[model samples]
Target: MDSFEQLIGKNINEVDLNESKTFFIALLEYDTKHCGKRYPSSKYKLADMDYYDLISFSQLFKKEAILIVWYNMDIITDLEIYYLSNDFDILFNDYYIIKKAIDNGLAHKLTEGDTKYLGASRLNEKVPQPHSDILANKREFVLKKKYLQKIIDEISFSCK
Candidate 1:
């Protein structure tokens, strides 16, 4: 699969792109609901995005059918895709990480013990560890509450 940038540029048609004001407006509503901020759009600055910005971008990218997989030390670390059936607006889909890894060639399932699936978005942490409360034993991927809350808090604080 192509990168988010490549996917959006290649997959979204010219007519859709031109008529996409509504799509972007819907995306804004989606972002506000999910990440508490409107996405910033500029072709030049994609490479410099921060975490929350990337979260915002991911929603729009997923809406355009882009699949984002963030890997950490060969674990199927983070997966982001929109649930289009529920709403025209975007929503996150959590996956059975172990199954996803095995299916996607990221890792093999272990018979016992916790399988660590670290977050690739550890912006400042010195070491990567379990970043979510969702049991690793369940083999599912979820963003950690504290990490997500911190981003939301920063968005709240900065906009104040």
Candidate 2:
């Protein structure tokens, strides 16, 4: 038997990417809902993105499909595609609470955990520890929530 990771497409679901593809992403500090119905077409300075600016960006960028798994360590956000150049209007887009942290910075250490999966350590401080409320409420978000937000596939994006 092969490991799931080794299994050809067994564990793979929606994400689609390749080593040669032009990968671009932003490490945004926000919730899934923050990815609005409209995406930011303007150029963003990835190194220094302000929360307010992000708020504006969020209001515009509605690409994340829906909530898949919103947890402490794996909060997937928006997944979108645009031209590599400054022309942001050209969008090859799809929406899903993405699970990849992407980058285009120069001379930066890139790794699996570094640019994939959303980290909610900042919320842990505020959220009640040993969260009894959450444990008690665990019946699958689908059952409790109005809909079991479906998984979507992006023709242009992929996650490893």
Model 1 gets an lDDT of 0.28
TM-score of decoy 1: 0.18
Q: Give per-candidate clash totals.
A: 1, 16
lDDT of 1 at 4: 43
- Model 1, stretches more than 4 Å misplaced? 1-136, 157-160
Which regions in candidate 2 have their CA more than 4 angstroms from the true location?
Answer: 1-21, 31-74, 84-160
Question: What pairs collide in candidate 1?
Answer: 97-139
lDDT of 2 at 63: 34
Give a tens-digit lDDT track for model 2, residues 1-160.
5543344343333233322234423322222333332222212221222221222223333333322222212333454443233312221121012111111221112221222122111111222112122211111001111011211222222233
lDDT of 2: 0.23
